[model samples]
Target: MRPKVFVSQPIPEPALDMLREVAEVTVFPRLDRNMSEDEWIMAAQRADYLFVMGGNIITTNVIKANPKLKGIAMVHRRLPVNNSIDLDTAKALGVPVVFQYPWEPVYDRIAEATCDLTIAMILDLAYRLIDADRYTRSGRTLQEHTMALMGPGVTGKIAGLLGLGKVALKMVPRLRALRMSVLYTKRTRLAPAQERELGVEWADQSDILRRSDFVCLEYDYNPSTHKMIGEREFALMKPTAYFINTARGRIVDEPALVRALQNRTIAGAGLDVFWHEPPGSPEMAPSEEFFKMDNVILAPHNGGATWDARTELTKATARQIVTLIGGGRPEGLVLD
Candidate 1:
């Protein structure tokens, strides 16, 4: 008998077909949202492998309900937190949970999205693109507009990256093409050869803040990094500098960011994630203040929401599922 796989959320058709070849696939009927707690527990009880996505809460109750379950495959691009899946429960149950890796196929798509958002934020702040669009739509022309909205250009500016990870590494060439010098700060410094190849200068967080025309946060979120950027760090930035964050929101203090924007301490901001993300509601943003601010660009925590990225992530998850089912330990095993 083929192993049964319960998918708690909808994935691409190609990945579904891939899993169908090796397992009896049972997908949650709803494609627009995740399954409820009861539904999730019921599904877990029925399947040998639970394939989950973001927003599905896999608690200890679900794990204990299914003693015959083999493992779980999570299709998230970032590190899975306890809210998504209770790793302690899975560890206690001796069920391995596999997560997606940054070196996998979906990293490029995420990197591209991050870079795109960073540029969009810069252009919007520098030129007031959103305001200009509103003016044009309201039957106004350049002749009627004054020089009040004129802002700085991006060429020959300094761009700072908080982390030199995969996303930040991909952003280097793009920043260089704009004739911008890139400064990066990481826990461990890169080799001289690598720095030369990527055309990035190593700097501490304070130096990056003081020198950069644009400060981009690309670091991972953890206990050490939580609230790393607060009022003091924001105060270090040049008044004309723009801040961009495509990584986790908890890395920066949201209230402090709101205060900075309100006071114009920093020029503007572009944010993709938030500290308190309402479950299954992608339309929600950080706060009402961000919605009213013209200097800010807000996304629904979906920087990597491109179709290509989704397909690639689904494929990667399918590969991991197949490997686990075939008695092979795949990469990104959360328990081990």
Candidate 2:
């Protein structure tokens, strides 16, 4: 008999087709924006496997309820200890938990794409050109202006990968090719040989902050990193610098950023994530003032939305589920 799996959230159509072929998959009928503890427990009881998102909670209690469960597969890139699947319980239960490396391609592509965008933004391409059609009507030319980037990640390559993890590994070569230098400050430094291999140098966190024209927050969030870039850090940045945060939202104090932009403490910023997902503010979209002013660019967390990236991610998730149901080790097991 095929194994029964419970999908706790909506997956794209292609993944659904693959899951149906290998397992009897049941997804919850209505999407709950956030699942309740009771719903999680009930879902665990019903399936041999669970494919979950990073935001979903899987507590010890939820794990204990699923006696028949074999593996919990996670599709999100970063899994914190407190939230999401409980690796300790899974280990005690002798269930192998898997994580799909969904962001690899997306990170590689974005590092390259972001470099391209950075060059364009530096050259003031968008500012210099008015819509050709609009030009005839207004008879006015917009003066081209340069954006002063706060971090040196894209241009100088003096980028510190807050965490020396997989995403940073892929981003290094791309940044180097664009004549950018790489710097990192972490709990443990990479050996001299490893740094040589990637052309990355180490910097004290403060030095990375003060010198970089663009600051990319590549570190994962922990208590130590939460609000790491607060008011004081912003104050240290050059008036011409722009900050870029594609990693997480809470890493920067959002309110501090607002004040910095308002007072021109830093030139501008580019943000892909927000402290609140789906920020329920009066501003409806990426083009609003909180983002579209003199020095900011906002993307709706679309760095990973390319067709190739999504297809690779979906296939990785499907393969993981298939391997688990076949009584074999999933290819990329993350949790012990």
On lDDT, the candidate that comes out on top is 1
Residue lDDT tens for model 1, 1-336 = 999999877778999998999999998887555566778788888999988876677778888889988999888744544467778888888988888854456777766776676666766766778777776777655555567567777788899999988778878888898888999999999999999988989999999999999999989888899999999999999999999998888888999999999999999898888877634232245678898888888876767666777778788888899999999988867744
Report the C-alpha displacement of residue 161, candidate 2, in angstroms. 6.8
Candidate 2 matches the true fold with a TM-score of: 0.63
TM-score of each: 0.80, 0.63
- Model 1 lDDT, full chain set: 0.82
Clashes of each: 0, 20
Off by over 4 Å in 2: 1-3, 8-14, 26-48, 59-70, 76-82, 87-96, 101-204, 220-224, 276-295, 299-302, 329-336
lDDT of 2 by residue, 1-336 (tens): 888888876666688788899999988665436566688899889888888754567778888997778888877655444356678888898777887665566456545554444334432322322223244456665444324322333444344455555555666676677687777777888899988988888887788778766566667766888899889988987776667776667677888998898899987776777776522221123334474465566665555555555555666777789888877777677644
The TM-score that candidate 1 achieves is: 0.80
User: Against the hidden true structure, what lDDT does model 2 obtain?
Assistant: 0.67
